[model samples]
Target: MARQPLAPVRPPCRLYLITPPHIAHLDAFAAQLEQALDAGDVAALQIRLKPAEEGDIRNAVQRLLPIARAMGVAVLLNDRPDLARTLGCDGVHIGQEDAPLAEARRILGPDAMIGVTCHADRDLAWDAAEGGADYVAFGAFYPTATKETAHRPELELLSTWQETVEVPCVAIGGITVDNAAALARAGADFIAVSGGVWAHPDGPAVAVSRFAAVLAAVAEEI
Candidate 1:
């Protein structure tokens, strides 16, 4: 049998939500995910399950993927190419600390989208592309209220990655409507957010829409 074609990359619009494993009320978050889709926000969702439980992650992904697909949102599983393959997700986002690119590629075959975390390093981005990653992720652009990590990626690095790599570059950590355009100007192809979207006082729906609106205005400029 032949493979399916990848979805055309939508012009940078909406937020990309990375779900934390600690979300106890999965149903509530499912509603939020539905809203993001309904509002035309959230281009994609990354199901990041910490502490690694394939069963639990698959359950969450199963509940979320249908909602996401119905709304035309792409769903990515973080760190597990096997699970992504089993569940037929849109992609897998792996870190430098995770599985090797070749192993992931073999499991996911040629069609699955692969995103690699390049951290703050340019060489890492180059290596990931050579290793078969579809997109590169850079992070801690602003202080993160979520994960605690020592490394902070600079805006200049975004320019460097954008210029040096063919794959789309994702800018993560503390991104919001206020700072999104600058990141976009810095040439970040995707703005990946967690707290910035899920922690907003109003709701994830509004927060994602705000980021989407910001991206829309910036896209027009470029």
Candidate 2:
């Protein structure tokens, strides 16, 4: 399918932070999250608690949602629109294997930000955008320990999507301060990071600050 052409200028790519699969200490993690958000421009935060019980997920959301929201970062719950709606999350991020996009939107209502994981598939991205998804994510651009990745998208995917689509695209999976600039230049509207930020040696604050610098530089060049 042919995509709509976008304007010559694009917005500066922003950061999207994802929580570690398991946040053992909600209070400590909340403080760390605040420090990261305070250090740079973060567009959204996805509460992605893997292999956790419903109670744990709820507790994490209850503790962390306010901090991200207070900083004006949209809070999205990963893979569970029903939970997200009940928990009052800003939105939900759904993977291909999760609930269908239309169903997710129906559950979250019209105003919710619903992002679909396209996983290097152009057809999936097109289907997602056409179905009214707020954004489409493409990646495992690099190897990541955060999760098991099955697709590795080429940089050209970002370039092509940026040039053709207007719905906003997120470059996720394995993005870091060192490699994010290439993705930014390739035309990702947001760079999603997990281990890249939370596990940084200097701490999440320094990681976010460095990512901001990289994105800013890329924005200037393109």
TM-score each candidate: 0.90, 0.96
Model 1 lDDT-worst window of ten: 7-16
lDDT, candidates in the order shown: 0.82, 0.95
User: What is the per-residue lDDT of model 2 for residues 14-36, given as tens digits with 9 covering 90 to 100?
Assistant: 99999999998889999999999
lDDT of 1 at 200: 82
TM-score attained by model 2? 0.96
Candidate 1 per-residue lDDT, tens place, 132-182, comes to 888888887888877876678889987876666677888988887789899
lDDT agreement of model 2 with the native = 0.95
Best by TM-score: 2
